[model samples]
Target chain A: MNLIGISINHRTSSLELREALHLNRDEIVSLIPLLKEQIFSEGVVISTCNRTEILGFPQTEGLDVNSIIGSLLQAKPIDGIKPEYFTRFFSCGAVKHLFSVASGIDSMVIGDSQILGQVKEAFEISEDLDFAGSISRRIFDTAIKVGKRAIKETTIGEGAVTVSYASVQVVEKIFANLEKKSALVIGAGESGELAAIHLRDKGVGKITISNRTIERAEKLAEKVHGEIVPFQFLKEHLHNFDIIISATSSNELIIHADEIKTAMKKRKGTPVVLMDIAVPRDIDPDVRKIDNVFYHDMDSLKIIVDQNMQKRKEQIPLVEKIVMEELVGFFNWYNTLDVVPTIKSIRSFFEEIRLDELEKIKNKVSDEDFTKIEDMTRRMVGRLLHNPTVKLRGFAESGANIKEVLTNTLILKELFNLEDFPTNGKSDAEENHNSEGNDEKN
Target chain B: MSQTITTLNVLLPLLYLTSFTVYLYDFFKEQKAVGNVNRIILFITIIVHVSYLLALTVEYDHPPITTKFEIFSIIACSIAFSYFILELLTDIRGTGAFIILFSVVFQVISSIFIGPNYKVPEVLRNRLLGLHVISALLGYSGIIISAVYGVLFWLLYRNLKENKFGLIFNRLPSLEILEKLSYYAAVIGFILLTLAIVIGIIWLPKAFPDFSYFDPKLTGTLFVWLVYGVGITSKWIANLYGKKFIIFSLIGFIVAIASLIVTNSLARTFHSFY
Candidate 1:
C-alpha cells in the first residue's frame, strides 16, 4: 500500500483550534465507520494537545487525500491548510516524522520524553483495530528505542526542563539554606504541590499546605511530610514562614497588601520570599511593594518559560540530524516495496508449474503409483526453487528494483500468462484529501 | 621530651587569629579563595593544635580540652567541623569560613591566655568540665557560623539598596541564601548549646559556687543564648528573614565570642605557659 500523512500542530494553531479538532475515543470509533462508508480506510488518527494527524495506507492510487479532510476541518482544503500550520509528507517522510515524535525528539522541549508512551498507546489502539500496517509497526518500536538512546547517550533529559523545576531553583538560589525555615504552599494544585516537594528536599523545617479543599491539602501534605494549614489561617501564619508559593485557582488575590503588612509586622522586618504561579495571580501586585517581601507572579514565570523554549530550540538541529538519518533508513526499506510482490509471485508460479506437471504424471500412473509420483515431484520443485527464491528475497531486501524490469518486459504474461499483483496493499480513499493533479507527483 | 613554649606560645592562637582577618578581608573583597584557603589553614592549624592539646594531655594525664585555652581551640575545631558540614550541604562556604576562622582564633586565644600552662585548677579537673567545654564550644561554633552569614546578609543587603553591585555580592551568598543558612545553623546550634549551658549551670555551684553570676561566664553564656534565641524566633514570628536577621546574628556572635574569651580569663591563675 502507498502511505501518506496530514498534520496540523501546536506550531500552527491556538488552543481554540486544537479543541475544535479533538476526538473522544467513542467519537473515533463511530467516525471510522463513517469514513469507511465514504472511502476505503486503512487509517489511524492521532489527536493530542499539540497536534492532530491522519496516517493512511491507501489501497488505490490517484485518490484525493484532502477530499476526506473536509469531514474534520473547515473551508476548502487549500485554504484550510494555512501554510504556517499544516504540512503533508508521503510514505518515508511520514514514517520518519512519526518516529521522531514517538521518541520525543520532536518535542518543543526536546527529551521531555513523554511522547514515546503516547505513541505506544496510539499503536495499541490501531493494533486492537487490527489496522496496524508494517511501516506503523516498525517505526513506532524504533522511535521508542531512539527516545531511550537519546536519554542514555546525551544529558538531554537530566536537567530541569519544566517550569516547576526552575521555580524551585529560584527559591533555593535566594535562601542559601532553607533547612530550618518553614514553607507555606497557598494552593494544593499540581504546580503548588511540585513547589512544595522541591522545598521539602531543601530541608525546610516545616511545610504548610493549604488548599480551598482541606482534604486535598491534607492528602498532598501527607505525601510531602508537610502540615495542613487552614486556608483562612494563612494570614496569621504568613509571618511564620520564610517562603510562600501560590498556585491556587483563585479569581481574587489570595494575599493582598493589607494581609502582607500585618504578616510583616509579626515578622520583625525579616523578608519573605513569595512566588505566585496562579493564572489570575493569587497575590496582589501591590504586595510586592512591601519591604522585605520578594514577589514574583505568573508573568515572570512566563518570561522564564519563554526563555527555556528558546534554549530548547537551540538543541533542535542535533535532534533533526537524528531524525534525518532514521528517515533515510525508513525510506530505503519503503522504496523497496515494489520488488517484494515480484519475488513472491515468482515463487508461486514455480509451485503452480510443479503441481501441473505432477497432475499429468498422475494421469499416466495407477492410483498407488500416483501418490509416489506426487511426493517426488514436490521434492524436486523445492530443491530447484529454494536457492533462487532465497536469493531473490535477499536481492529485494538489499534495494534492487527487480519488479520494474519484470513489469516492463511483461515476462509473466509471455511465459505463464499471470496478471501482476495490485499496486498498494491498503485502502485509504475513505477521506482522501488529495486532489487529482497531486497523484502525478507520487 | 615536650618542647618549651613561651609567651610567644600565644602565637599558636595568633596563627588562626590572623587568618580570619585575611578571611574577613576576602569576605568583602577577593571572595573566591576563602573556603579553599581556610580549609588548608584549618587542617594545618588543627594538626599543630592537636599537638598543643597533646602536650597539655601529657601534662594532665588526660584529654586537655578542659582548660580554657584547650577548650577554646577545641571549640574552634568544632566550628571548623560544622563549617565542613555546611560546605558539603551547600557550596556557599565563603560566608561560613570567616566564622570558623573566628572560632579558631578565640579558641587559640583561650588556650594562650587562660590555660596555656600545664597546671589546671582542682575544681576544673573533672569529666564534666570536658563535657561542658566541648559541648558549649561546639554549639558556640554553630552560633558563630550563623552570625558570620548574618554579617554577609547585612553586607549583601546594604550593597543591594545602595545599588553598588559590590564585591561582597560576588563572594557571598545573596541575602536570601544567607538568611536560610544562618537560620538553619542557629536552630541546630541553639538546641545543642542550650543543653551545654544548662548542664554547666547545674554543675557550676557544686564545683565552685565562687564562680559568680556576674562573672564573664554568666554574662557570656546568657548573651550567646539571647543572640541564638533571637535568630530562631525571627524565623518563626519576626519578619526576620534574609539580610537583617543575618546581620544581627553576626554582631551577636561577635560579642558572644569576645565575652567567652573574657570568661576564660577566670581560669587564668592555675594554668601556666608550657
Candidate 2:
C-alpha cells in the first residue's frame, strides 16, 4: 500500500540537470529491476524529454529516498546531483501526479498529448520486465484510461496553440477536406518553410514552393516532397492553388488585391485560404474584401493562437475532473481488495457451521426432509450474512480513508473470532484445502 | 381518437422544444455527453411526431393536410425528418440546433391552433391531393433548409472576412460546404416543387371542374418554382456560385414564404379546401 514516487520535471530542475540525469530505455530497463531488488515490490520509470520520474510501491515504510536517488544516479550519473532536486509524493499525491502527467495537463506545453503515449510505453516496459504488482498494474491501467478519456471527452488537445500551427488551423477551418486541395508557398524562408511543412503534414494534396531564390525553394520543396514553381509565376498559378501561404522579407506586399481577385474569378467561387505569416505582411490585406478568399495575416494567426491557448486553459478543470473520477474508481477497487478476503471468510465460516449441523441431523430425517433442511439452512446463512457483506463492500467502495476500511475489517474479523490470516488475503490452510479439493475433483 | 389527437397536439411542441434544447446545449457546450444524445432526442421526437400525425389522420379520417394548421404540423415533422436524413448522409450534426429550432417554432404554432376540420371538402380526401400537398410541404422544407444554410454561409463568410475567429467561425461548416449544401438543397426543393405542380395540374380540372389556371395557389407555386429554377440554371450555365448564389437562394426562399402566406391566408383561393 506504500505507493511513492519522485519527479524531476521542467518545473523542479534546470534543463541541463534534467538532461544529465535523464534515463534512456536501457537504463530504465536496468533500474526498475534494481529498484525492485533493493526496496520496492513493484516499480516503473517514466522518462520523457520534459520529465524523468521513478515510481514504486515500497515493500517497507523505512526505505531511503537517498538510496533510490543513488540507484538512478548510478545508471546515468551527473555531477552535483542532490535529493532536493526531486519532488517527492506519497500514495494519493503520486497517483494524482501520474494521472495528470498521462492526461497531458502537467507537461511543459499544456496538452502536449504525446505524453500519454509515452506513459503507456513506460507502463508496458515495466509490465514486460515483470516489475508490475497488482496495485501498480491497476494504477497504470487507470492512468492510460484517464488519458484517453480526457482527449475523447474534452477539447484539451484541440485547436492550434502555436503560430505555425495556427495557419494550419485556419486552413482546416476553411476547407473540409485538405487531401483534395493544393497549397502555394511564396517564400522559402524559415517561416515559409515551416508553414509548408505544416501544410504537407496536414495532407494538403499537392504543395508547390515558390521563392525569390530557386535553390532555397528547391530545398524546401524537396523537404516537403512538393513541386517547385518559379516565383515569377506565383500570381499566374494562384488560380490553381486552394491555399496561398506568403512569408517573405519583402517590406511591401508581394501579393496584390488585383492578383487575388483574378484568382477568385478563375476559382469559380471555390474558396481559398491566404495565410501571410511573415513580418511586415506579405499578402495584401485588401484580399479579405474579395468573396470566397479567406485571409489571415501574422497578427490574426497570433490572435487565433491566443484564443486557442485560452480555450485549452479553460479545459483544465474539466480534464482534472476526469482524472479525479478515474482516481476514485481506482481507489474504490483498491480498497475493496482488502474487504474481499474478509467477505469470503465470513461466508466460509457460516457455511461450515451450517454444513456441520446439517450432517448431525442427516440420519434423523427422511431424504426429502433432509433436502428441505439443507435448503432452509442455506437460505438462513445467506439472509444472516447479506446486510453485513453489503455494508462492508459499500464502505470499501465509498472511497473513504483506507485505514477506516481496514479498521472495520479488523473489527469484523475479531467479532467473528476468525483465524488470523496473511495480509496477502490468503491463508496457508485455505490454499492447502483448495488444492486438495481440486485434486479430488480431478 | 380525438382525445389522443388532442393530447399529441399538446405533446408535439413540447417534444420538439426538448429536442431543440438538447441540440442547442450540444452546440454551445460541445460536451460529448450532450452531443452523443442530441441525435437520439431528435430521433425520438421525430417518432413521436409521426405518431401524432397518424393519430390526427385517424381522428379526422383524412391525412393531416386538410387545413393550414395541420399542414404546418406536417411541415414541422418533415423538416425534422429531412434534417435527420441529411445528418446521416453527410455525418454533419453541428447545424442540428439551428435546423431543429425552425421545427420547434412551426410545431408550437400548429399545436396551439390545431383542431379537427370536419368541413374539409371531399376533394381533400383524394389520395392524389394528399400526395400533391405532402410533396409541396416537403419542397417548402427543402427551401427552408437551403435558406438556413445560406444564412450560415453568410455569417461564416463575414466572420472570416472580418477576422472574428469566434465560436461561430469555429463551429460552422466551411464556406464551400455550406454553399454546396445550400445549392444542393435548392435543387432538391426545385425538383419536389416541380412534382407538386405537375400533380396539381393533373388533378386540378378533375376536382374543380371550373378550376382556373390563375388560381392563386397555381400561380404562387409557379412563381416559387421559377425562382429556384432560374437560380439552379444560372449555376449550371453561367457557373454562378458563392455569395451570389447564396443570395439567390435566400431570395427564392423569401419569395416562397411570402407566396405561401398570400395564397393560404390573404388571397381567395380554392386551395384552402376547408
Candidate 3:
C-alpha cells in the first residue's frame, strides 16, 4: 500500500527531455507489465505534451527508480539522459501531486481542462492492462472527482486563458451576441488567422479576410469559410464589419483615425471592435478616441489574459483544500484496511472463550436457566469488546501517525495471542515469514 | 388577524433587507453559493409579501389597492415577481442587487406610512379600477426593471470600452444580453401600460362625468406611454439598439417616475387616490 511517483514536467525538464520521455499509447501499454515486474505491484503512466508522470504502488519498502527508468527505456530507448531529470515523490507527496495535476492546477496553462482527461485515459489503459490495483484505482477515481468539483464549484475555468481566446472575449463584451455580428481579419498571418478562427468558433455570422496579397487571404478565407476582400477596399468596407482583427507585419499603422471616423459615420453609431495584435501596431492607437469604437492591442489583451490567470491562481487554495480533504478521507480508509483484520481476530477470540465456557455449564443447568445464562454471557462478551473495537476504528480515522498505529496493532496481536489468526486467507506463519524477510532487507 | 398583519409589517421589511444584503454581497463577491442563498431569501421574501397582501385583502374585504401604502407594496411585490421570472429564465443574478434594493426601499416606505383605516372612494371601488391600478403599477415595475437593466448595459459597455475590467465588468452579463432583457421588459411594460390607459379611458366617464381630459395625471400617463411606444417602435423598426435603446428606456422610466411624483404630490386628479 506504499505509493511512489516520478514526474518530468515543464518546470523540471526541457522540451527536448519531455518529448524524449513521453510515452505513446503502445509504449505505455508495453511498459506497464515491465513496470509491474521490475518496480511496483501496480502502476499508471500519464503522458501529455507538458508532462510525463509515472505513479505506482511499490511491493517493497524502498523504490528503485533506476529499475522503473530501465523499464521505460526498454519500451523506448533514448541516447543520453540520467535519472536526475525526473523529480520523485513518495506516498502522500505522490498522491497530492497526482491530485493537483488532475485538477489542472499544475498545468502549464492553469485550468486548461485537458489534463483531467489525460489522467483518466492513463488510468483506463492501466486498468485494461491489469496494472492498476484497488489503491491506485481509488486514487484515480478520487482525483477525477476532485477535478470535476474544481471546475463546477469555482470560476477557474470561466474566462479565456489565452490571448486568442481573450480577443473573442473582448468582442463579446461589446456586442451582446456574436451570432449577428461580422468580422474582418486585416492580415492573413498567424495571429490574424487565429483570431478569425476563434471568431468563427464563437458563431460570428460572417468573416472577411484581407491581406496585401489576395492569394494568402483567399487561402485563409477558404479555411474559415470567410469571404476574401481586397486590401485596398479595407477602409471602404470597414463599416460593414462589427469586429476587426489586425496582425500585419507593417511597421506603420495600416488603419488611421480619419479612416475609422469615416467608417463610423457609415456605421450609423453602431459599435465596432478593433484588435491590433501586431508588434509595431496595426490599427492607429488614436482611433480609440472615437465614440462607439473599442480598440485593444496585444498589451490590453495580455492584461485580460493576466487577469484571468490571476483569478485562476486565486482559486488554487480552494482547490487545494478540496484535494487535501479527499486525501485525508482516502488515507483514513486505507488505514482501516490494516486494523480491520486484527479487529476481527480479537472479536472471534472473545467469542470463542465465551462459547467454550457456556458449553461446559450447559448440562448442569435447567432449560430456562440455561437460556438465561447463555444470553447473559453473550451480552457480557459484546459489552467487553465494544469499547476496544470503537477505539481501534477511531484511531484509524483520526489520521494519527501510521507507524504508531501499526506498532499498536502489533502489540495487540502479541498480547491477545492471536498471531495464528489468518489474514487475507494467508496463514499467520507465512505473513510472519514475509515481514521477517522485509525486516531483514531493511 | 390584526396581530398577524402587524407581525408581517415588521417581518416583510426585515426579510427584504436580508435579501437585499445577500444580493448586494453576491453582486460584489460573485460567489455561486452566495447567489443561491440570495435567491432563496428573495423567494421567501416574495412569499411573505404575498401573504401580507392577502391578509390585508381579507381584512379590508376588497383588493389591497385602496391606499398609498397598499399601492407601493403591490408595486414592490410585482417587481420582485417579475424579476424572479426573469432570473429563472436567464440565470442572471447580478442585477438582483439593484432590483431588490429598490424593492426594499419601496416596502420600507410603505410600512412606515401605512394607515390602518384608509377607505376606498365609492366610485374607485369597482373591479375595473382595481384592475386598472394593478396593471398600471405592474407596468411601472416592469419599466423600472428595464431601466435597471439599461443602466447595467451602459456600465458594462463603458467598462469594456475603457478596458478597465473592473468588478462591474466581470460581474454583469454581456452588453447584448442586457440590451435584449431591457428591450423585452420595456415591451412588456408598454403593453401593460397600454392596457391600463385603455381601461382608464373606458371607465373614466362612467365613473366621473366631470372628469377632465386635461387632468395632469391623465396627460402624464399618456405622455409616458408615448415615450415607451416610440422607444420600442424605433428599436423594432429602425434597428436602433444598444446605447440608444438603453438611453431611451432610461428616459422613459425617468419620465414615468416624474409623472408619478407630480400626480401624487401636486395634481388634484381623481387618479390620485393616495
Write model 1 residue lDDT over A78-177, tens digit each, in one string. Answer: 3334444556767667777776676565665666767666667766776677666555665666666666665554445543455566666555545655
> Deviation in angstroms for B109 in model 3?
1.6
- As for candidate 2, its clashing pairs are none
Question: Residue-wise lDDT of candidate 3 within A230-269, one digit each (tens)?
Answer: 9987888988999999989999989999999999989887
Error of 3 at B267 (Å): 4.1
lDDT accuracy of residue A85 in candidate 3: 77
Residue B194 error, candidate 2, Å: 0.5
TM-score of 1: 0.49
Ranked candidates, highest TM-score first: 3, 2, 1
Candidate 3 docks at the CAPRI level of medium
The DockQ values of the predictions, listed in order, are: 0.23, 0.50, 0.50
lDDT of each: 0.65, 0.86, 0.85
**lDDT, residue A109, model 3:** 90
lDDT of 3 by residue, B1-274 (tens): 8899999998888998999888888888777777478888889999999999989888877788877888889988999988998999998888898888788998999998886754767776698988898889889988999999999988887777777877887788888889999999999899999999999999999998988999999999999999999999999899995889999999999999999899889879877665
Ranking by DockQ: 2, 3, 1
